[model samples]
Each structure stands twice: as C-alpha cells, then as structure tokens.
Target: MITAYKKNDMTSFKIKVVGVGGAGGNIVQKIYLSGLGCETIILNTDSQAISRHRAHHLITIGKTVTRGGGAGADPDLGKKAAEESIHEILLKIQNADLLILVAGLGNGTGSGASPVIAKYAREKNILTVGVFTLPFEAEGKKDVAFKAIAEMEKYLNTMGIIDNNVISELVSMESSVKDAFDLVDRVVKNCVESIISIVQETSDVNVDFNDLKSLISRGGLGYFAKGIAEKPEDVDKAIESVVFNPLLTGVTISDVKGALINIKSNGELTMNHFREILDKIRAHLPEKAPIKYGLQKEGDHRVDSYAEIYLIGTTGKRTTDEVIDKITSKQTNWKNFEIPPGVRKHKK
Candidate 1:
C-alpha cells in the first residue's frame, strides 16, 4: 500500500483542475477518474461536449455567441467566450491555492480561452500552471497554437507541454482509434498526476505544497519526468530517461534555473541511495545550480529494491515578445505555413 504523509493538511490547499477546451476537458476527466482528490471542472464552448463528459462541474462558455454549439476552430471566438463569461469563471476559481489549466491548443476554446483564464488567475494572485498539447501538422493548427502559446507564456507560472506530433510518432501509431486516444490521455493524466502527487503525497522528506508553489511561481517552462529504476544504480538512469520523455517533447535541462528531484523506493530504500541519485542527476546539469530533493519509501511487500525517481524543475525564460517574434520571423520569406487537413476530430 502507498503511504501518504501530512505536514500541511491536504484540506488546506484548495486545488482546482480546470479543463479549458475539448482536449483540456478530456485530460481533466482522466485525472478526476484517478481519484487524486482535486475539484475537476470542464469549461467549453460546446454544451453538448461538456454534457457528455463527467467531472465535478461543467461550464459552458460563450453561450450567446456559440449558442452552446462550439468554437468552430476560431481562437478569437474562444477568447471572447471566456471574456463574456469571465465573471463565472473567476467565481469558480476564487480562493484556489493553485490552478492547473489543461487543454490542447489550436482549437477555438483551448487556444483562445487558455491564455485569458491564465491571466485572470495571475491577476487574482493565484499560481497557475498550464498543461497543454500542441496540434499535429495534420490538424493544421500548429501555427495558430504557436501564437496562443506565446500569449499564454505571459501569464502562466509554468507550462508543461506535450506535442501531439511526437505522441503520434511514439504512442498513437499502429493503434486502433480508442486505443490510440487511451494512450494520449494516459500521457496527459501522467503529467498532471506527477505534479499533483509531488504536492499531495506525503513523504519523510516532505516536498510539500509550498515547495511546489515556489518552484512553479517563477513563470517559465516546467519540466516533470517520472519513471522506475530496477536497481540502486539504475536511479540515475531513470532520471536520464525522463529527460527525453515524450511528454516534454522539446526541452533541454542543460540550463535549468531551479530544480527539484524526488525518488521513492520500497521500505529498503536508504539515504545513501537517495544522495547518490541526487549527485548523479546534478552531475548532468549545470555545475552551480543547487538541487532540492526528497525521498519516500512505501512498505509494499510485492516490491523489492527498486526506485521511482521524478525530476521537477523550471527555467525562468519568459520573453514572450522575443520568442514570438523569433518564431514568426519577419526576416525570412517563408511559405504560407499552413498545416494540412484531415486530422482527428477535436477533444479536450
């Protein structure tokens, strides 16, 4: 059985997992089903879509404009929907200790509403972290998604990203439709789960909610990786595998500003094993950066001497204007940059 610790009571931290669009809603649904003990809500322009999903709450935005139909892949309308219903959204998010915004950018609701809601949460002094999936080239939404991401960087405390193209190459290929989506949802669920578990799961080392708050509130990109190590020596290897994990698609840890490393094993885990894991992980990173780490060992008889190590950290590089300008460079005479159509249908 898993042993959960308590220093700052879990009840004191009010966490709301808000699903922004169809994709976001779907991800949040999986997280809710995992029973992580957070309030889950789905926000969408599609009334029909939200009605079909299961969550603690369902919020339909831009009811007057979209008539409860959908955003029609228009980011402008998605933004307007959130704007029109800003009051209700804020009310729902009020007093939240942390907000995890889940969505797949490139759709009207996800692309448009994500940035707006993030900015609103920041205005209220609530820490916000965005978990998102980029559109595939087949979906013809990358260019649009890029613009939305640039805007979101301004308000989000940290962005945890997964590229759909990478997911296609690594996970969804060769699988049936339902199975493929199950794989996709698992990635999203794992990303959200890893972070929440860091805060909610108690340990002897205690990487509590406040520690996570300090790590995320720096306003840059967030990196989270978790995997198992079969042997004591495999602890470092587990962390290395996470660096190239598909969920983080395109990030490098060479220049991380701040980092938190966590490792867990069965009851036989030792402090020496934990220290070596931290040392090995740091050896791969920049020399000067100090690392914060924690350890936990659950007394499960079925498990032996194995370790599950997670690396959670962020680099402060929120230069929204420069990044967008570099992305949409005026210096180059590039082609129309339009993605091809005939991709899968939209979902949160």
Candidate 2:
C-alpha cells in the first residue's frame, strides 16, 4: 500500500475515500490532488490501470484470477476478484470513522467490487456513504447498474446518485463526451468537499461530526448540491440554485427527513445571511425534519468575494421508491432519440 498524508492525524473525524475501477480511480485521484486532506485508496484488477493513479493508497486485486490483466467488462469476475482480495481491502478501511465509496455502476470492477467493500465497511460499524454514476441508456448497462445500486443500498447509510442519461440531456449538443464526464466528476468532488468543510471547519454556530452523523446516518437516498453567490446581494439566488438543481430531479424536499446547509464565504458572514438561507430552506422542508447548518470562512477578500451553499438532504421510504423509479424507468420521448444498446430502430 502507498500512503500520502497532509496531516499526521488527518482530521478529528477521519474520512476515507475508496475508488473502485477506472472511472472511480479517476474520481479519487481528482479528490486526492484537490487537497481535501482525506485518506484515498484506488483499487483495480489490472496492474496497468492501478499504476496510472496517484493516491494515498494504491491496491491491485485478483492477482490469481486476472493475472495482472483486467476484468474484461465482466462484473462476475470483478466480484470474484474483490472476494479474492478481501483481506487487503478490509485493512485499508478498518480505521475510518466515515467511509465514502465512489464508483460508476454498469460493468466490471466498479459495479462489482464497490458493494462488496461497502458491505465489509458496514459490518465493521463504519458509517458508509456511496456516490455513484449510472450508465447512459446507450451503454446497455442499466440492469447491471440497478442491481449494484440495490446491493449498495443494503449496506450504505445514504447515497447520492448521478444519472448520466439526465446529464447527457442537459449538456449542450456541441459538448464532447469527455466534457460531460468532467461535469459528473465535479459533482462527486463537490459532494466530498461539502462533507469535509462541514466537519473540519470551526464556526460560531458549529455543526460537528456528530451532527452530520445524526442527520445522514441510515437516512436513505440523499440529495447534494452546491450553489454560489458572487456577492452578498445574490445569496437568495444561490439558495434557489441549491433547491432547484437538476441533479435533484424527482426528489421532494417536503418529504425530506434530514437537512444540512453549509455556507462558506470569502467575505464576512452575517446573521441576516444565515437567516435568509435558513428561512428559505425551512420553507421547503417539513417542520418536524431536523436541520443543521455550518459557516466557514475561506478565500481572500482582496481578490474575490463569494458565498457557496452546500445543501445535503435525506429522505425516508416514501420518496425512496419514487426516486428509484425515476432513475430505472425508460423514457421514450427524448428529443435527441438515442436508442438503448442492442435495440433495432423501426422504419418510418
């Protein structure tokens, strides 16, 4: 195992991020290099693939099964590879207070190994959360993706999902495939950054690690979004961005069971800034739902002035079914009309 540390103790609440497979490895590398100060591990079946990443720890699984090759897009082989390397995987995550698993579900290692690792983490009494991306309809991996998601939910405390189909529809027609993927990566990175800021930064009205645990732990199907205001005058507009983010499509805020609102600014934060953001958030959530907020000061006022709103909301069983349906169901009326893989197009 390779290790890199910014702090000897990392943080009071240790967060470990483990990325499984190619897509996951790329995401973890971005997080590590971004200087989030979290312990990161990147695991792959292929030696060549694992060599490409620089992280806190790098691991190669299934030496016997794959012989340093790869899983060949087969999730079964991916699962077996992880099972073959369970001991090593368990060692990397044993000490973490919070374990965040990142993967793109559909094929091979990410779809296969992530759920297994999460199951192990949950058994160790770690608070596990998952951030995953769904394959587009054209990829023909919906069945595999949904199956992995079900397995993950069985073990994770909460999860944030990004549907590639939704993202594809939202991006400009002229944008390349790489550009679309970069946006997905940014969304996952923002989620991790939000968590880090809330627990690591000190505030007058603080939301500690325990507060976050109470709100998100075992609260299924969560939504996370980040919004920014260039100056104090635009704070309301930022709140609107947080609430109406396209990533949160099909989720109902009124049914939300728990909420966390973190505001980070380059300039001085005031009582009115907090009240305005909180009141707007409160209007959408149920009165009985518990809420926590954290304020953090960052950046330099001389160069730029901005307030970032990081909103995390979790829902109960009622919205969970609705949200899952929205992701797994087929939509035939899309304007672009990309066919699912292996389907023949009908003649006019």
lDDT of 2 by residue, 192-305 (tens): 776666666555445677767876784577767666777888787777766654543335456567777777777565768867877887787788777777655444343254
Residue-wise C-alpha lDDT for candidate 1, range 1-348, written one tens digit per residue: 112234546445778899989999988988888787788989999999999888998999999888998998999999999999999999899889889999998889999999899899989998888888877779888888888988888888888777756545443234566666665666667667667766655566656777788878876667766666777667655656655454454444654567776666777667786666676677756776556666665634544658876777776676876444433331211121111133222323
- Model 1 segments more than 4 A misplaced: 1-11, 229-237, 270-272, 297-306, 321-348
State the TM-score for model 1: 0.82
| Whole-model lDDT values for every prediction | 0.73, 0.74
Best by lDDT: 2
Winning model by TM-score:
2
CA RMSD per model (angstroms): 7.5, 7.7
True-structure lDDT of candidate 1: 0.73
Clashes of each: 7, 0
Q: Give the least accurate 10-residue stretch of model 1, judged by summed lDDT.
A: 330-339
